[model samples]
Target: MIETLTRIPVAHYSNLKARAGYSIKIDKTEIALFKVTNGEVYALENRSPHPKGGVLSEGLVSGNYVYCPVYDWKISLVDGTVQAPDEGKVQTYQVEIKENIIFIVL
Candidate 1:
């Protein structure tokens, strides 16, 4: 259910560095959007699941996971799932890019 995305526009797509995340502030929420691969875009909570650590925008992207810099915890960017062993999860959003603009669904 795309409840928050107002419109699907060509987002300002940029060539993100390897293992890095990007953020955009929308509706007062410091949202984090990630492009892990050339063909994949994943959006997750800007805040870490553990403690009050802020998942830096420039995070390491591995496959479908993003490693949190605060604690080195691996988080699944696709579904906000903890990698393994760790029992923590973060909020994830849906990313849709049309033409080039990214429309994130909350």
Candidate 2:
């Protein structure tokens, strides 16, 4: 069966700074939203994938990757894959922007 996607409006594009992280919640899921310098937006699970989980929203954003603030594990915001030497993955959400409003697909 095909899964249905729901688009939920979360924040305004103008309110999100480039290369920064914004935290949001959908139901029980906590998401970290990142706006890259290139004007692309990505959404990932707020929690890191390391054994000792860190908050992805508090991580450093460089290019399309975020370094887990706690363990310094590099995670890809585009696909939520933990970088080499690290063995794990976070959850990623589809993001859409329309008329400056950011929507997360779930």
Candidate 1 contains a number of clashing pairs equal to 4
Tell me the tens digit of each residue's lDDT in model 1 across 22-98. 87777677667777656677777787787767564656778878877878788888888777777688878777776
Instruction: Record all residue pairs in model 1 with backbone atoms less than 3 Å apart, i.e. clashing.
Output: 10-101, 11-100, 11-101, 11-102
Candidate 1's C-alpha runs over 4 A off are 1-5, 8-10, 15-18
Lowest lDDT 10-residue stretch of candidate 2: 48-57
95 Cα displacement, candidate 2 (Å): 0.4
Off by over 4 Å in 2: none
The TM-score values for the models, in the order shown, are 0.81, 0.96
TM-score: which candidate is best?
Answer: 2
